[model samples]
Target: MTDLAGRTALVTGGGSGLGAAIATALHAAGADVVVVGRDEAKLDAVAARLGRRARALTCDVSDPASVEELRSRLADTAVSILVNNAGVPGPVAALTDISVEDWDAVFDVNVRGTFLLCRAFLPAMIERGAGDVINVASVSGKRPLAHRTPYCASKMAVIGLTSTLAFEVGPAGVSVNTLSPGPVEGPRMARNFRLEAERSGGSVAEAEAAFVSRAALGRMVTEEEVGRAVVAMLDMPGLCGADVDLSAGMIA
Candidate 1:
């Protein structure tokens, strides 16, 4: 658990769900963790669970100004690990049904957010010649997800960024890897099921079943698995420009 001792990690959207889980795992691995999100209360709650070696800050990853402010705030802290976990699921509807605003909103957060955070932090990591950047993309990025064009496209963008950024920063001893998780069980997914059911005139159970069936394991991955995977990837010093799928065999 002390594998990351003496290191500092900054996790965006660390207030809840996968982000919170990742923060906890990093903290457990002995990294000083800074959890950032739009919700102060949720961030505080996650910080509380982390006890020592954890603190909370609020920032909108999609906002350049906010990210710049965050960079200013962490000027004294050398963030060795950056987890771009903040993302929106976007509207669960066909591309034609999804509005321009909805589509842009997804890209702004899922794509632009990752870019802003990297722009704000990568320089220091390159200067120091040591760091890890994990972008939480989704399996939807590689596969076509029905009725979720915006989400799929945005994630693909993140995936592309991870690989290209790794190639750019690897010489500086920085590792940039994409963590693409499959359908995860949580409120977000529950809401997706609700919307999908409403769209297809099917029960929520049916909607869930259809999605889960795509995974070879016939089950969704858990947030903890993802958190641990982040730790695992970080532990591997040679891992760079890699898309590690923790999706329970959702290869189809």
Candidate 2:
């Protein structure tokens, strides 16, 4: 068993979906969990569900001022674990049809936000001599999806960031790894597909089926599955700097 007792973890986007799962998993493993998101009510609800081990904070990962405030709230306590799980799936559109604003919005949260949060928390980890930084990327990072150009580009950037950060921080005892989840079935996924279905004049079920059929697994992946993978990574020793794919049989 990977013991994480007494460790302090900060998970961005913890108010919903995979972020919530990661936060819950970390808390269940005895870590002091801090859940961060833009929704204070949602964050509080998640924290309440997580019991005494979890703390909720509202922070917009894309905002530097909010992040600076978050750092101030943490004071001098060293954060042993940081999970950059906050990301926007981006508006679905053809590459040529994508608006500049949409592209910037996607990159701002997925790339710039991830970079800033790491910058804020990493120095303390370096000073402490050990830490875990889990960046929740996607299989889209490795393979592109049509009409998801901006999201693909942002995730690819995340993979690049993960690899580079891992190389730079491994020497300082900070293990940075990326987890790429497949078609995780949840509210967020449903919302994304719903929007696409509306745009394309198709049923949500059709959109979902299309997504599942694209995966070699022949089904939509579950939140629990992704959660387990994340918990597994956090528990592994000598598991730094790896892009572990949880895409079922998608690669083959």
Candidate 3:
């Protein structure tokens, strides 16, 4: 068991779902956690539940100004763990029909935000010779989805980013890894399923079931499952730069 006692961690998108799960895990491991998200109320609620060790901050990862503000605020704090989990589902459009604006917007959060956050935090970690960065990518990063051109492209870019950063920072005691989860059962997934159901003339239940059936595990991933994996990564020593696929073997 790895102990993060007295360590500081910053988790983006920690207002709910997988982000909350990772924050909780970090707290349980004895780390002081800072949760950031666009929703102040949601961030507050999660931080409150996470106890005194957790603090909440608000920022939109897609906005350069917001990210700059976040960097300023966190400058004085020694953050050793960085989880880049904030992301958009991306505007659904066929590759041939996608707009430049739509593609840029998605890339802004998934790629540019990841880039900025890493750039902002790495100096401190490098100086101290310790840190871990987890980028919450998706199976779509490795495999293409029918109508998710922007998201897929952005995530694929993330895979490359994770690998390259891991190599560059590994010698300095900073570990960077990417996690690509299959479909997870959460409010986000439910909303997506609902939309697909309506658009495809299928019931919501049917749509959800179809998603599960296509997965190698024949089930939707649980928040707890993802939480534990992140926790494990935090615990592992000398581990740097790996694409951990949590797709339940569904990559095929």
In terms of lDDT, the poorest run of 10 residues in model 1 is: 1-10
Candidate 1 segments whose C-alpha is farther than 4 A from its true place: none
Candidate achieving the largest lDDT: 1
**Which residues of candidate 3, in runs, are more than 4 Å off?**
none
Which candidate gets the maximum TM-score versus the true structure? Answer: 1
- Model 3 residue 244 lDDT score: 85
Best-to-worst lDDT order: 1, 2, 3
Candidate 3 lDDT by residue in tens digits, 1-252: 468898999999899999999899888888999999999999999999988889999998877788889989988899999999888887665778878988888899889889988988898999999989999999888775777789988998998999999989999989999988888878888887887777688999998887777777788778888888888988777667888888776686
Every model's TM-score = 0.98, 0.95, 0.94
Clashes of each: 0, 0, 0
lDDT against the true structure, each candidate? 0.94, 0.88, 0.87
Candidate 2 residues 1-252, lDDT tens each? 456788999999999898899888888778899999999999999999999978998999999999999999997656899999999998888889989999999999999999999999999999889999999888887886878999989998999999999999999999999998887888878887998898889999898888778778798778777877877998787888899988876645
Query: Given candidate 3, what's the lDDT at residue 62?
Result: 72
Candidate 1 vs candidate 2: the lDDT winner is 1
Which residue pairs overlap in candidate 1's backbone?
A: none
In model 3, which residue pairs have backbone atoms overlapping below 3 Å? none
